[model samples]
Target chain A: DVKVTQSSRYLVKRTGEKVFLECVQDMDHENMFWYRQDPGLGLRLIYFSYDVKMKEKGDIPEGYSVSREKKERFSLILESASTNQTSMYLCASRTGGIVNTEAFFGQGTRLTVV
Target chain B: AQSVTQLDSQVPVFEEAPVELRCNYSSSVSVYLFWYVQYPNQGLQLLLKYLSGSTLVKGINGFEAEFNKSQTSFHLRKPSVHISDTAEYFCAVTPSGNTPLVFGKGTRLSVIA
Candidate 1:
């Protein structure tokens, strides 16, 4: 089984604070993703990295950025946390197979910004 | 661009009752379809995926879905549902390559005693 480990399960931050959510995959997958889960809007991708030091913006990447300094680790950075950014964060990774590879997900981190 | 739409926001059914969750997608290129179930506060788990081959795809926990090309729909179904099946179901799609999946709003399944 593949393992995607998240740095924290729950976090509380004040408004205007910078936050970092780290993720690491042991399977050496080539693709890593960060997503935010809200009540009505299932899971929306914030950022994704296909290789080391390579990142792409997803549909909702306005206030978020990502860093992939290594192949096994991807990080999501919230430049300035706000109350609206409080939600569940998920990390997923997939291999670079020719066909579509199923993404394996982390347990998710519930973030609360007050 | 690819997008997925789950028709029902919530579906209520009694134990052992049949249920269906409708999903539709819009994509200009050939895509891959997937059904994922999230239990309570847990993360999403893959229930089934339609890459190609048969139109009817069987998945874990006695769930299955059929792919309709003309309708551009992939609807999940189960003959008899259990209380454990109550969860949030999401439909997602992506192009036929290594890319991120576009997810729908999700349908909440509530099973009564």
Candidate 2:
């Protein structure tokens, strides 16, 4: 089965603490994305990587950064976790092929900033 | 850039009743549309996708969506819904070429028995 795995399913951090959310995909897809899933905002993209070391900011990139050093791993970093940053984070990877463009998603990481 | 709009934030329906979740998109480039469902506490799953074929596309769990280019809408519908169908539905668009998808705010479908 195709899989996108998030290293942490749940996490808690103190305010102003640095946080790292890891994601890995076995599909070897060219496109990987980081998204924040809020109650009503749905999946808001934070950042996406189209290739190794190549990244682009999405609609909401403030206070968040992403790294794609390898083909299989994409990481999201929060410089200073805040109370409002508490939300479910999702990781997804999609193939570049236009014929088959469905994305595979990870289980998700629920982070709470105290 | 492409953007998606889900008209309803929530839809409450009884079991076995028909349902429709509306979605509209804005984009200048050609686009591929998708419908995804997310159960509580889980990741989103692809229900169906419209790449570039028939306007009416059938998906998993007896759900289907009609793609209307004139209206720029792709609406998901099910003739009869089950309790298991209660979940959050999202509409997404991928503008032609190499680009990530843009998702709507989502529509919550609550099926009451």
- The DockQ leader among the candidates is 1
TM-score of chain B of each: 0.98, 0.98
Give lDDT tens digits, candidate 1, residues A1-114: 779999999999999999999999999999999999998988999999999999999989999989999999999999999999999999999887676867888989999999
lDDT, residue B14, model 2: 99
lDDT of 1 by residue, B1-113 (tens): 99999999999999999999999999998888999999976878999999889999999999999999889999999999999999999999988557898899999999999
CAPRI-style docking class of model 2 based on DockQ = medium
Q: Score the docking of each candidate (DockQ).
A: 0.71, 0.65
**How much is the lDDT of residue A39 in candidate 1?**
88
Instruction: State the TM-score for model 1.
Output: 0.97
Candidate whose lDDT is highest: 2
Q: State the number of backbone clashes in model 2.
A: 0
